[model samples]
Target: MATHLDLEEQEQLDQIKHFWNKWGTLITTVLVIVLGGFAAWNGYQYWQNRQGMQASALGSAVEAAVNSGDKARIDQAFGDLRSNYGGTLQAAHAGLLVAKAASDKGQMDDAKAALTWVADNASDDGLKATARIRLAAVLLGSQSYDEALKQLDAKMPTEFDAVVADHQGDIYLAKGDKAKAIEAYRTAYQKTAPGVEYRNVISVKLNALGEDVK
Candidate 1:
């Protein structure tokens, strides 16, 4: 009986290892994000007043350019922020705004560039994860399936788990890999909290694949 139980335990361990190998460190990272909340992304209380004011000014310039509908101006303003205030929340905020403007103008490359910088340089994991998720969406729209998946490869805040898996499902589905798509959607559905509207969205995706949301 002892030998049989040991075999069963080993099998379970192997199954767990297989899941870990597939998902990398996200499972562990998810736990940390929940316990810690990785709260720094909420604000930049440590910045000196002058530095904060300067960043805010540069952020305003980026917004003006976006409002002007001038891509060149947007580029120039965003360039100034990232060059001089790259580490500030204002810079990260500008990146997101620039990406939206770029996407609206159908400048996929520009959108990717802005989002990539935020993903690579944002001060906190939650913000970086936001960039990665947006970058993946842009890549998916461009039909760069592999590249999109790469953006989501890193461990992120637990809050982003559902979004990451949903993006993966879209990428896999775009590649016509129904099996992988379904698996990714299932992961998304399970991770999403009950009664969240987004969880219902994942359920719809799974249902389209002939899979129950259970």
Candidate 2:
């Protein structure tokens, strides 16, 4: 009986060895791949966190410059933010602030440049749409009617559709296209939130264009 038990145990050991011989390398390879992928993901997350911190710091610098009313410092800090952290949403928000400051300082070209950057590169769709609308307004002020219309024609997020239409109405009115202006005003009126002041403004625009909005 002891001899028989010994032989059976030896056979089981041999079977396990054979199985390992066949699959050890494959199992090791799979584990290595999975672990490497997990490590890479962690590394990427770490890098993103570092980037976010840096971007937030630069954004603060931009705000400081804007507050100081220092046009040159604002321009420099904004350029740095755009160059280094353009992928971050903070960059877009900072760009908008810079554009507003530049516009207030009569730096029309600088304002347009800042707004163009946000319109083209903002991470958020709504931010991009807002940038486009503001940029269009700037262009309209400059009498760049065609360019203003082009900016307004960019795809807007659903939440911004009404505002974009209102801006389009303004652009059309500026261009003396009263028919298109009325149409855009009507669209805005239909899209605006019920009982909002903007809705009332749209109603006024429609009335001005001789289009009754019931």
Candidate 3:
């Protein structure tokens, strides 16, 4: 009986060895792939966290410079932020802030440069549209009517179409093109929603041009 039990145990051991010999390499490969994937995911998460922290730090620096009322500091800090983290939303906001501060300080060149960068590089259409409008205002203030109109001609977000048309009307009026300005104001008046305060403003502009729209 003991001899029979020994034979049964040996037979079980041999069966396990046969299974291992057939599938051991496959099992090891599967484990390596799963573990490696987990490691890569962890590494990616760490990298994203690090980038967010770095971008936030740089944004804080720009905000500080802007608040200090130092135009040169705003320019320098924004340049650094743009060079290193231009793809971040922080960079977009910083660019706009720097532009506004530069404009307030009468640094038109710096303001234009910063607004241009934001207009060209902002990831969101809304932000890009805002930058273009502000840039057009700056150009219009300098009596560059054609250049301001050129900026306004770029594609705008749906919500900004009416606003852009109105701005174009302002540029045309500034350039003494009453016909085009009237046409633009008419378009703005038509596109705006009824009873909206903006629609009232457009109505005022259109009435000044000797036209009315429902």
Each prediction's Cα lDDT score?
Answer: 0.90, 0.91, 0.89
Relative to the true structure, candidate 3 has a C-alpha RMSD (angstroms) of 3.1
Query: Candidate 1 or 2, higher TM-score?
Result: 2
User: Per-residue CA lDDT of candidate 1, range 6-66, in tens?
Assistant: 9999999999989989886887888878766545433344455667899999999999999
What residue pairs are clashing in model 3?
none
Q: What is the lDDT of candidate 3?
A: 0.89
How do the residues 94-173 of candidate 2 rate in per-residue lDDT, one tens digit apiece? 99999898888888998999999999999999889889999999999998989998998888878888988898889889
Best candidate, lDDT: 2
Per-residue lDDT for 181 in model 3?
Answer: 93
Give Cα distance to truth, residue 177, candidate 3, Å: 1.8
TM-score (C-alpha) between model 1 and the true structure: 0.76
